[model samples]
Target: MVIADLLGVAKVAAITLNERGRISHWDDTATELFGVAPPRALGRPPAALLRLPREHRGAFEPGGFGHVWCGACTLPRVDDGEPAEVGWWVYPIGGTPGERGVSVLALAADLRRLRRDGIGITIGDLLLAPPDRPAGDAAPARRPAAARLLRVEPALTEPSGDGADTFAA
Candidate 1:
């Protein structure tokens, strides 16, 4: 019930995949975003059915290097289909997505957004793809995976004329 409520309340499209890459949970926003209804979409491979690249398949595997994977991808131009340069993330945690075996929470965008705006690396970019370096240059050292997850509280305030004072960095 809690999982359904959270996914249902999400304003964006959210998809949860089973261990075999089949669609286990598809939110209402996903129906609107992908033009596919639930129950019908269940047990279907999202990559092949939706024409998405298979690079994200690594997100659901056990003993995976990371918990989050972000990348820019293009969705096929179906009947006036979704965004082209949309960014998505695979958040495979223990308790989130749906209750069952390991679930991979895949969030996709329908607009031309480059990346997730506010959901930055509160957990640090541990297994993220390393940045590009010039020729002959050694790769930068990876940061220690010691930064704890940061919890943020969204606050709303009336216009105080002093803009930018409402949010804390």
Candidate 2:
């Protein structure tokens, strides 16, 4: 059965950034993903908290243009320095940074886990294509029917012996 028939990515962590590109909210998942708790992560710029790739160094900066930027990143855990491969999608909220400013929501997932689970996701799949503008404003890209569906293993669709018929991921 199709698990999801839409453009989306699995997110393992959620972080909210204020207009200044500083962490405003860090959820429990964020703590687990980055090993940085809210107490130490809040108010800190993403650059200071995570080691972004050279090309993506400006990922968290307010681009003045409100858009969704998604890709992969490798970051060392703040607590142990252990590296983690993370997939990310960053999008602005409220308005562009130049206008009234806005809060940005950043969602990340562990790539290793996604791969192990047989989820075929990629940056290109997430964006559909390199976005020319914010995901909401841009016209959806046209793609083959095969590309729109995510195939799920029978184990995920098969219900347990329990009375509830819920699909487990």
Candidate 3:
């Protein structure tokens, strides 16, 4: 199935942003969630459509596209009731840091739903989880290093009467 069809059925908004923060692919669910249809929003700067503040707009810099700039940004629902908190995932989409054609994918979730589901871990809590190392303090044994050079004597062409080949050092 096509990506557009997949996005439509998932009920999750999928937005693709260019290096300059312009909208590339604004899927169906994105239109429903943001109330800005593709016909009008495609190719336009995302900051303008979302009404992002100047300070926050810098988060879309090509190098910073996919890193989580703001874990949550509160905005009123389209119907205009209580504000909803939306988390953002920001990081560079295409190629390395300085390459062109970078894109950003923003996955937004309703904070209310998250709270109802008991998502309580803070960023610090997640980052500070116990380090994955053994608790024992025993030091490992070290093997002795071998000398790199080895000397060998030439073998004598004639064998000794004792039937042993003699080697001269």
Candidate 2 ranges beyond 4 A from true positions: 1-11, 64-66, 94-102, 118-169
Backbone clash total, candidate 3: 7
Q: Write the per-residue lDDT of candidate 3 for residues 39-111, one digit (tens) a residue.
A: 8888887676675546667665555434556566765544343465665655556564233354676655555
lDDT of each: 0.54, 0.66, 0.50
- In candidate 3, the residue pairs with backbone N, CA or C atoms under 3 Å apart (3 or more residues apart, or in different chains) clash, namely 65-90, 65-91, 66-90, 66-91, 66-92, 67-90, 67-91
Q: Write the per-residue lDDT of candidate 1 for residues 78-167, one digit (tens) a residue.
A: 336755555576787665435575467777655442133322222223322222324455444343343222333233335447665544
- Write candidate 2's Cα lDDT for 29-85 as tens digits: 789888888999988888887877767756677655457789997878889989988
Q: Candidate 3 lDDT (Cα, whole model)?
A: 0.50
Superposed by TM-score, candidate 3 places the C-alpha of residue 72 at a distance from the truth, in angstroms, of 0.7
TM-score of 2: 0.58
Off by over 4 Å in 3: 1-11, 64-70, 76-82, 94-102, 116-169
Q: List the residue pairs that clash in candidate 1.
A: none
> Which candidate number maximizes TM-score?
2
